[model samples]
Target chain A: MDLSSINWLLLIAALMVGATPILLAAIGELVVERSGVLNLGVEGMMITGAICGFAVAVKTGSPALGFLGGALGGAVLSLVFGLLTQVFLSNQVATGLALTLFGLGLSALMGQSYVGIRPPATPKLDLGPLSDIPVLGPILFRHDPMIYISILIVALVWAVLFRTRAGLILRATGESAEAAHALGYRVIRIRLLAIACGGALAGLGGAYLSLVRVPQWTEGMTAGAGWIALALVVFASWRPWRVLIGAYLFGGLTVLQLNLQAAGMKMPVEYLSMSPYIITILVLVLISSGRGRISTSAPAALGRTFHAST
Target chain B: MLIRHLLAGAAMALTATGALAQDDGEPLKVGFVYVGPIGDGGWTYEHEQARLALVEEYGDRIETVYQESVPEGADAERVLTQMALSGTDLIFTTSFGYMDPTINVAQKFPDVNFEHATGYKRADNVATYSSRFYEGRAVIGHIAGKMTETNKIGYIASFPIPEVIRGINAAYIAASEANPDVEFNIVWAYTWFDPAKEADAAQALIEQGADVILQHTDSTAPLAAAEQAGGVVGFGQASDMAEYKPSPRVSSIIDNWAPYYIERVGAALDGTWESKDTWGGIDTGMVEIGEMTDAIPEDVRQEAQDLADSISSGEYHPFTGPLNYADGTEWLAEGETADDETLLGMDFYVEGIDAEIPN
Candidate 1:
C-alpha cells in the first residue's frame, strides 16, 4: 500500500468539512433533546433545508442567504411537528417519522427544477497570516463559515444548557413538564421553541451540504447524514461537546477510510467502509459510559408529550 | 367468411384481455422501480429517459408509472407486488440490488413479466438485461490514461458487484496499456446514489493527486467535484453529462436502453415475450460514447476513437490474454479473450492493481 501518497494534512482538513454537517445537525438535536422533546425528523428538516437553501442560493446567487432560507425552511417544517405534538397532542416519534417522509417528498417536489444546478460557492474564511501556518492553518482556518458556525453552535449550546436560566427552564421542562409547568415555566412554548431551534440548525447543516460540500442541488442529496446526526445526539448522551467529538470522529473516520482506500491501503474494504460507524459508536460509548448507564444521562421527559392542562 | 374471421379475432382478443385482467381497449400498464431519483442525471435518469421513450413510442398504447428512490430490498418487493396487483403488465426493476426482489416478486405474479437491469437472476417470467458498459470504460480509460499529468487515475466505484468490478478492470487494462506509469486509486462508496458521498469520494481522489476521475456510481456529483477542483478531468457516467463538457467531463458513456425497452414492451404486448439475458454493447447501439470535446488532445482523441471503434466492431476485447489475477495466477495466456461466464462473475482484480476487492 502506498501510504506515502496520502496527504495527511489535507485529509485532516477534509475530515472537518465532512464533520460539519453532522456536527451542526447533532448539536441542534442535543438542544431539542435537552428541552425534553424528541423530534425524529432531523432528516426531514435537513432535506427541506437542503432544497430551500439550494433554490434560494441559485435564484439569488448568495450562499449566505441560501443558508438563511434553509434555516427558515427547517424551522417551518419543525413547527409542523411542534404544532402536532405540542398543541395537537400527537406522538413525537410518529410525527418525527412522518415529518421525515414529508420532508423527503416535499424536497423532491421543490427540487424538481433545481436538480443539476450548482449553488453559489461558499467562500472560505480567509484568515490571511493564520491560514498560512504550517500544520494548523489548512486544518483550522481555511474552511468556509459553516464549519466555525457549527462548532460555535455546539459551544453556545453547552453554555446555554449549563449557564443560562432559559436553558435551565428548558432542561427542567424536559426533565418533568408538570414540574416545570407548576413552577410557572411554559412547557409547551419552550419545547416548541427548542424544536424550532433544532430544526433551524438541522436545516443549516443541510444547507452546508448543498451549498458548500457537494455544492450542487440534487434530490435527496442530504442522504443519511441527518440520520447520522440523530444517532450522534443520542450517543453523545444529550451533551453538546460530546456530540462535536462524535461527529468529528465519525466524519473524520469516513474521510480517512476513503483516503486510505485511495492511498491503496490493503485493509478489507468492508471493515474500512463501516469503520466510521463502528469507531464513532465505540469511542463515544466509552467516553459517555464512564458515568454509568447511558439512559441515566438522557432527559427524563424526552419524547414525552407535554400537556400543561393534563 | 370475412365477418366470421373478424368475430373470431375479436373473441380471441377478448379472451386474452380477460385472462390478463384488463380490457382490450385499455393501454398496457408498465411499472418502473428506480433505486434513485430520476433527476440524478446519471443511471436512474437514463432509465427514466427510456421510460419516457416508451411512452412516446407507444403513445396511447402504453401507460407508464414509476416509483423513484425505492430501496432495493423488501421495499422493492412490496413496490413490485403493488404494481403487479395494480395490473401492471410489465415491470422493470432497474438496479443490481433489485435482482432478488425482482425474482421474488416475479414468482408471486407469474402473469406479469419482469425485466431486471444489471442482474444475473432470472425466472420463467423474468428477464435480465444490461449493457456491456466495460467496452465504454475501456475507451475512456485510454483517454484518461493519456490525459493524466500525475499518472494517478481515481475510480469512484459503487458496490463490489461483478458489473462494477468489470468496469474497473476494463478501465485499468486499457489505461495501463496506454501508460505503464498510470496507477488506479479505487474508493467504493457502497451506494448506488448518494450525491454527497459520491462527491466526497471524488474530492478524496482529487486531493490524492489523481488528475483523471472515473466513477461507476450513478450521479453527477463526482463531475461537480472534479469541476470544483480545477485541473482534474472526469468522464460522465451512465448518462452524457453534457453540461460539464469542454472541461472536467471530457466525454461520457451513455446507456441506450430505449430501443431495448421499446422492443421488449412490444413483445410483451404481442404475447411473444420470453425470459432471456441480454448483454448488448456498442455494436448493438446499447452503449454510446459521448462526444469527446477539444479538451482532449487530437492524438489522444483519435486513439480513443479508434479503441472504441475496434471494441464496437468486435475486433478487440478489453480483457485480452497475457493477463494475470492480482494474486499472480495466470488468467489468460497470450492472444486469448475472456469468456462471457468469467466476465459476468468476475470477483478478483487483474495483475498490477495493488488494492484488494472488498468482499
Candidate 2:
C-alpha cells in the first residue's frame, strides 16, 4: 500500500462533507425518537427534501432558499405522518413504513422534471486567515456551512433534550404518555412537534445532499442514507453528542476505505467497503453499552400510539 | 415443486391466450426492466433512449413498457414474471445482475422471448447481448493517459463483475501503453447508482493526485466531482453528458442500443427471433465514441480516434497479444488476441495495474 500518497487533511475534510447528510438526518430522528414517536419515513422525507431543494435551488439560483424548501418539503411530508399517528392514533411502525413508501413514490413523481438539473452550489464558509492556517484550517474550518450547521444542530438538540423544561416534558411524554397526559402535558402535540422538527432537520440533511454533497438531483439520489441515519440514532443510544461522533466515524471510515483502495492497499476490498458499518456499529455500540444500561436508553413508550381518552 | 407446476400451468394458459391475441394483429408488447432510474444519465439512460427509439421505429405496431430502478435478484425475477404475465411478447432484462432472474423467468414463460444484456446465462428462449465496451475503454484510456499531468488516473468502478473488470484491464493496458508511467487508482463502489458514494470516490482519487477520473457506475456524480475539483478531467460513460462538455467531460463512450433494439424487435415481429449471443463493437456501431471536445489536445484526439478506427476495422483488438497479467504471467503471445470465453470470464488485472480485483 502506498500509504504516503493519501493526504490525511483532505480525507478528514471530505469525511465531514460526506457525513453531514447522515448526521443531519440522524440528529432529527434522535429528536423524534426521544419524543417516543418512531418514524421510519426518514428515507422518504429525505428524498422529498432532496428534490424540493434541488428544484428550488435551480429555479431561484440560491442554495439557501433551496435548503428552506427542502426543510419545508420534509416537514410537510412528516405532518402527514403526524396527523395519521398522532391525531388518528395509528400504528407508528406501519405508518412510518408506509410514509417511506409514499415519500419515495411521491419524490419520484415530483422529481421527474427536475432530474439532471444542477443545483446552485453551496459555498464553504470563508474563515479568512483562519481558513489559511495549516492542518487545522483544512480539517476544521474549510467545510461548507452545512457541516457547521449540522454540528450546531447536534449541540442544540443535546441542550434541548437534556437541559430545558421543554426537554423534560418531551422526555416525559416519550417515557409514559399516560403519566404525561395526567400531568396536563399535551402528549400528542409534543410528539407531533418533535416529529415535525425531525422531519425538517431530515429535510435539511437531504437538501445538503442535493445542494452540497452530490450537488445534483437524481431520482432516488438519497439512496439508503436515510436508513443509515436511522441506524445511527439507535447505535448512538439516542444521545445527540454520540450521534455526532458516530456520523463522523461512519463518514470517515467510508472516505478512508476508498482512499485506502486508491492508495493500493492490499486488504480485502469487501472488508474495507463494509468497514464503515462494522466499525461504526462496534464503536458506538461499545460506547453506548456503558454500565450495562443499554436497554434503558430507548424511550420507554417508543412506537406506542397515544389517544387522549386513554 | 407443486407451486412450480401450478405456475407453469398458469403461464402456459396465459401464453396460449397471448398467442391467440397476437394472431388478431395486436401490437407486439416489448417490456423492459431497468437496474436504475432512466434519468441516471448514464447506463440505464442509454437503455431508456434505445427503448424510445424502438417505440419510434415501430410506431404503433409495437408497444413499450418499462420499470426503472428494479433491484436485481428476487426483485428482478418478480418484475420479469409480472411482465410475462401481462402478455408481453418480448422482454429485455437490462444489467448483468439480471442474468439468473432472466433465465429463471424465461423458463416459466416459454412463449415470451427474453433478451438479457451483459449476461452469460441463456436459456432456449433467452438471448444474450452486450456491447464491446472495452473497445471504447481503450480509446478513452488513450486520451486519459495522454491528458494526465499527474500520471495518476482514478477509476470509479461499480461492481467486480467480469464486465467491469474487463473495462479496467482494457483501459489500463491502453493507458500504460500510451504513458508507461501512468498509474491507475481503482475504487470499487459496490453500487450502480449511488450519487453520494460516487462523488466521494471521485474526490478521494482527486485528492490523491489523480487528475483524470473514469467511472463504470451509472451516475454522473463522479464527473460532477471532477468538475468541482478544478482541472480534473473525465469521460462520460454509456451516455454523452454534454452539460460538462469542453472540460471535465472531454469525451464519452456512448452505448448505442437503438439499432440493435430495432433489429431484434423486427425479428420478433417477423417471427424469426431465436436465442443467440451478439457482441458488437465499434464496427457495428453498438459502441460509439462521442465527439471529443477542444479540451483534448488535437494530436491526442487524432490518436484516440485512430485507435478507435483501427479497433473498428478489426486491425486492432483491445486485448491484443504481448500483454501480461498483473502477476507478470504471459497472458497473450505476440500477435495473439483474447478469445471470447476468456474475455467473458476475465477476473484479473493486466500487468502494471498495481491493484487486486476485489471479489
Candidate 3:
C-alpha cells in the first residue's frame, strides 16, 4: 500500500482537526448526561451553531463573535427543551426530538442567505519558532486556537466534575434528584444550567465545523455530528477523560481509513467507509461488557423526570 | 387494511384538490422535491437555480413550492403524495434515490405529472430525465492527463451506479488517450453530498501522490482540498466553483437544467405534458463545460474546448468502442458505440482502473 509515501505529520494534524468538533460536542454532552439529562438535540444545536456562527462571522468579520453567536444560538434553542421538559413537565425524549427537528428547520431558514459565503478565517496559533520544533511542534502547536480550547475545556470539565463542591451537588442531583431536592439543591435549575452548558459547547463544535472545518456554510452542515456526540457520551461511560479518548479514537479511525484509500489499499471502499462506525460500536460493546461495571457508571437518574411533589 | 384505507383516503383527497384547482382559475402549481438543501452549492443548487428560472419565465402563470432535504424512501413517498394532495399539478423529484417513490406517488395521482431526475424507471404519468455528465468528465480527464506530473489521477466517486460508472470510464479513457501512463485511484465515498467526507477524500488522494483529482460527487470540497494541499488540480462537479478558479479548479462541469425545466413546465401549461424519458447532453445544454481558466496551458485549454464542442455536436461519443472491462473482457469492439441500454445498466469498471466496483 506504499505506506512510506504518507506524511505522518500532516496525517496527525488532519486527525486533530477531524476530532476537534466531536471532542468539543462530546465533552459538552458528557456534562449534560452527567446531570442526568438526555438531550438528543445535539445535532440540531450543532447545526444551529454552524449557521449562526457562519452568519455572524460573515457579518462582523470576526470569527470570535461568530463562535459566540453560535453558542448563544444553541443555548437559546436548548432553552426550549429546558422549558418543555423542566418547567412544563413534558416528556424529555419527545421534547429533545422536537428540538432537533426545530433546530434543523430553523438553521436551514437562517442559513438560506448565508450559503456560499465563507466565514472569516480563524487564524492558527502562531507559536513563533516553537512551531518549528521537530515532530511535536506540528502535532501539538500548529493547530487553531479552538483545538487548544477544546482540550482546555475538557481539563476544566474534568476538574469541575471531580474536585469541587458544585461538582458534588451536580453529581448528587444526577444520582438522585429527589434526595438532592430534599437536601436543598435546586434540581431543575441545576439540570437546566447543565443543558445550557452542553448546548453552548455543542454550538462551539458546530461553529468549528463551518468556520474552520469546511470554512463555508451549507444547510444541515452538522449532518448527524451531534448524534455522534450523544453516542460518544454513552460510549465513554459518562467520563470526561474517556470522552476525549473516544473522540480521538473515532477521529483517528476516520482519518486512517481515508489515508488507506489514498494509499490504494486493496480493500473495498465500503469497508473503509463503514470501519469507523463499526469500530466505535465494537469498542463500546467491549467496554460495556467489562464486568458490567461501565454500564452501571451511567447516572442513576438518567432519563428520569424530576418532579418535586412526586 | 388500515394502511390501504389511509392510502385511499389520501388519494381521494389529492384528486379532490386537483378538481378544485381545475374549478378555480388558479395558476399552475409546480413543486420541487430536493434530496439535499438548496444551499448545497452543487447538484441541488443547480436544480434550485432552474426552479428560480421557471419562476422568472412564468411569473404570474405558475406558483412554485419546494421542500428541501427530503430523505429518500417512505418519507419521500409521503412528501410527493402531500405535494400532489396540496394541488401541485407538476412535480420534479430531483435525485436518483427518488425513482421508486416518484413512481409510487405517480400511481396515486394520475392527474399530476412527475419528473424524476437521474432515474430510469418510469410510469404512465412519470418521466425520467438525466444529463450526459460523462461528456464533461471526458474533458476534465484530458486536462488531468496532460497536467499530472505524478501520473496518478484520483477519482472521488459517489456510488457504483451506472451513471457514476460511465463517468469513470469516460474520464479514464480520455486521460489514457492523453497520457497512457496515467493511473487512476478511485475512492467510493458512497454519499452524494457530505463536505467533510469529500474534503477528506480529496486530502487522501493528494497525500497518495495524485497531483490531479476528479470527483463525480457533488461538492466543492475537493477543490478546496486541492487548494489547501497546494499545487493539486481538480474540476468542479455539478456547479461552477468559480471562487476557486484559475488554479486548483481549472474548469468545471455545470449542470444546466433551466431550459429543460422551462420547457416541461411550458408543456404542462399548454396541456401537452406526457410521460417520456429525456437524456440530454451538451447539445441540448443539459451538460455545460464551464470556462477553462488560464491556469491550463493555452493548447490544453483549446483542446478541452474542442473536445467539448465535438461532444456537443454529436461528432464524438465519450463511450465509443474498443473498450474492455477491468477483467480484460472485451465489452465494446472497434467502431462501436455503447447503446443506451448498456450504458444505463453499466456495472463494470473499464480497463486501466485498478479497483473493484462494490456491490
Model 1 is docked with a DockQ of: 0.66
The models' CA-based lDDT, in order, is 0.89, 0.90, 0.87
Q: lDDT tens digits, residues A198-257, model 1?
A: 999999999888888887887888888988998888677788888988898888878888
Report, to 2 decimal places, the DockQ of model 2.
0.72
Candidate 2 contains a number of clashing pairs equal to: 0
Which candidate number maximizes DockQ?
2
**Where does the lowest 10-residue lDDT sum fall in candidate 1 chain A?**
A286-295
Go through the candidates in order and give each one's DockQ. Answer: 0.66, 0.72, 0.45
Give the proportion of true interface contacts each model preserves, from 0 to 1. 0.80, 0.80, 0.46
Evaluated with lDDT, which candidate comes out highest? 2
TM-score of each: 0.92, 0.94, 0.92
Write down the DockQ of candidate 3. Answer: 0.45
* Model 2 DockQ class: medium
lDDT of 1 at A270: 73
Candidate 1: fraction of native contacts reproduced: 0.80
Superposed on all Cα atoms, model 3 deviates from the true structure by an RMSD in Å of 8.1
RMSD of 1: 4.5
lDDT of 1 by residue, B127-222 (tens): 999999999999999999899999999999998988899999999999999999999999999987888888889988999899999999878889
Superposed by TM-score, candidate 2 places the C-alpha of residue B202 at a distance from the truth, in angstroms, of 0.6
Regions of candidate 3 where Cα sits further than 4 Å from its true position: A269-291, B1-26
